[model samples]
Target: MAIGDILVDVQAVAKHYGDGETRVDALRQVDLQVRAGEVIALLGPSGSGKTTLLNIIGCILDPSSGRVMLDGEPVFDGKWLRSDLRRLRLDKIGFIFQAHNLLPFLTAAENVSLVLDLAGWPADKGKERARELLDYLEVGHRAGVKPALLSGGEAQRVAIARALANRPRIILADEPTAALDSKRAQLVMDLLRKLATEQEASILTVTHDEKIFDRFDRLIHLRDGRLVDE
Candidate 1:
């Protein structure tokens, strides 16, 4: 509502890879806004820049041109403004990748606790919060299990808990349900929607799971690195 209240904003953003004969435009003058307590789906085919846009928004990649402000803070103006971008990411942005990226040696609870600890939480508090999130996500029973021992759905849930351990303002998910079956995917989507609404955090997900598109507050379509509406 207010100017400083926007969770995520991208204005005239663009990204290109390679040079000359090998050039590829990953994003083209993209404009997007995500507000608190809302979930947005970036829907498009491969090469449509869905993930590219997500990366830009998450501060994983800098846009070639334009601006990206997170929670009213100008982190990028084509080039990153914050010298400690990694710290900013850890503090404000949570990331869920398709790979689940959990530490192989750590149990599910430990994986989640690691993040909280890194964010300056006390060891006991971090573990307690991790357990809380795991229970909230219905993964409490598997909290002691390792990634190799967990199902695709369980692993993903753990990854989500790890992402949320820091209580970030924004959650950026890239194909979060890619590894799950339809039923599990639906369950995850439902959980994501509920989390965004209940936590008052903004969620931006890049997904090809069209069956769950109706669950999101908004859907922004992309084609050939550009926004398109039907």
Candidate 2:
């Protein structure tokens, strides 16, 4: 991808936990670049640093060394600037996890609206945006339903709508379809790919499910905390 197309750039990044004898290298000189409108799958076995790398990219964790750039701006340079990093995570990055992690008490629209609220959007505007996202995700009818009332697929779609609530440029998903059946997993992957194209968002998803590999624009392999040729 061209330099201008790059949404996220991780240059020779490394992460080490603890110190001295107890120190463990979670990542080693990992380099990755994700461009806009692309869906990339991060494939690796357990303890391969997939989650660690994703967390670093998502601004949830800082690398021990190297730099991370978002939209051509440095977000992490050895140390993460707390104020700026928090804002960047809220405004530019969206995250999805293995579980839906929805607020059980809130309705679908409300669950999505909560994110906009945290971003300082006005109440009326947040509610409107939430409804719009639900409608777009084909879950408008379930807007008033609570998490317990929605099916697994519907809840997952709502969770996706929530991730898109901030209109983030980059999305980091960790095993988003791990709990779903094969058919449901396919549906979720299809929706994610569609979102990447239609929303022009860059998505880096960490997944162990090989069944959904074909849905990604690229597959990045990680082994022993280092990126390997695919």
Candidate 3:
């Protein structure tokens, strides 16, 4: 891809935990580039560092060595600027985890609006956006419902709406479909693909479900903490 098309670039990145005898190399000279409007899947077995790499790219963790560039701007250069990292993560990146992580007491709309509230969005605007997102995700009927009242698929859809609330440039999802049934998993993957194309966002998702593998624009494999295929 051309330089201008790249939204995320990871260059020779490495991560290590502990030191000496207890040290574990979580990543090894990993290089990856994600372009705008692309959906890439990171496939690997458990403990293969998929989540580690996702965390690094999402600015949730620091790499021991190497660089990261987001939208042509350097975000990591051997050291992380904590404040900048936090700001960029909120403004430019969205994250989804295995769990919906919704605040159980909050209504669906309220849960989605919380993210906008953190970004300093006006209350009315945030609420409007939240509703729009929920509607778009086909969860509008559950806007006033709490997580405890929604089905698994409905809850996941709300989580996705919240993730897209900020219109982030990139999205990092770790096992986003793990809790869903096959049909729901396919629905989620299809939504992700649609988001990539319609929103022009780069998405990197880590998943072990081979059934949904064909939904991705590209597949990346990790083994022994290293990227073995792209």
Q: Candidate 2 overall Cα lDDT vs. reference?
A: 0.90
The lDDT per prediction is 0.89, 0.90, 0.91
TM-score list, all predictions: 0.95, 0.95, 0.96
Cα RMSD for candidate 2? 1.8
Q: Which candidate number has the best TM-score?
A: 3
TM-score of 3: 0.96
lDDT of 1 by residue, 1-230 (tens): 33225799899999999999999999999888888888889998888999889888888887999999998798898689999878998998899989899999999999999988888889999999999999999999999998999988899999999988898889999999989998989899889888877777899999988888888888999999898962
Ranking by TM-score: 3, 2, 1
- After the best TM-score superposition of candidate 1, give how far the Cα of residue 100 lies from its true spot, in angstroms: 1.2
Candidate 2 weakest lDDT stretch, 10 residues: 1-10
Question: Which prediction has more favorable lDDT, 1 or 3?
Answer: 3
Clashes of 3: 0
133 Cα displacement, candidate 2 (Å):
1.1
Candidate 3 segments exceeding 4 Å error: 1-4
- Each candidate's number of clashing pairs is 0, 0, 0
Cα lDDT for residue 166, candidate 1: 90
